[model samples]
Target: MDDAASIDGDTTRPLSQAELDALTDQLIDKLKTVFDPEIPVDIYELGLVYKVDVSDDKDVAIDMTLTAPGCPVAGDMPGWVEQAVMEIPGVRSCKVDLVFDPPWDPSRMSDEAKLQLNMF
Candidate 1:
């Protein structure tokens, strides 16, 4: 993931649907590397990531939540996510928005995440 990228000397053009999908996949892979401080599972599998949006200009936006509002890393998790996403190629910028609405629950966890935590 590099911060410097341009397509044909233009960075404002919207990406094609296929291009967006491919970039999204890459973004997910990068996101899977971030882990909750207390959880062995990555944030993606842990269900912290609620939404990922990519704009025409390749800007990235993430909507996410924490395991708990009182979690020690509450102040830093968003930045961590932003940094991770910003590292991806073609990502012009990244913004992570933390939200507790529709609050996180065990049901949100991926099957793999549940298995890893022995929640089954």
Candidate 2:
């Protein structure tokens, strides 16, 4: 239980390495639960999730993009991601940002996603 003391009774300090690692794993697990409606694979595997940043206070910020900027679910997918992130027990907040600078391409996808999509 002591090892789980993320706050260490001081919220101002940064989370320990172990805490960060655990939280990161949990965040990825949560992110993997969110999916693009049109895609059978989760957004994480699809490479839609560009970045995930966690603040000292356990706030999560995500940068993600869609298969296409005009995709039908663009407006709702971020919320789905936020919902998934907020499910983590220790997460204090979640924010999802949609970005398009480096537009999505097949190259970003994981091998598993490629296999699932039959993109071999």
Number of clashing residue pairs in every model? 1, 0
Best by lDDT: 2
Candidate 1, residues 1-120, lDDT tens digits: the string is 445456787545457789988998899898899999899999999999999888887788899999998999999999888888888877889989999998999999999999999999
> What lDDT is obtained when candidate 1 is compared to the true structure?
0.88
User: Lowest lDDT 10-mer window, candidate 2?
Assistant: 1-10
The number of clashing residue pairs in model 2 is 0
Cα lDDT computed for each candidate against the true fold: 0.88, 0.90
Which candidate number has the best TM-score? 2
**Stretches of model 1 off by over 4 angstroms after superposition:** 1-11
- Where is model 1 poorest over a 10-residue stretch in terms of lDDT? 1-10
Q: Over the stretch 1-119, how does candidate 2's per-residue lDDT look in tens digits?
A: 33343445663566889999999999889889988889899999999999999987888999999999999999999999999899999899999999998999989999999999999
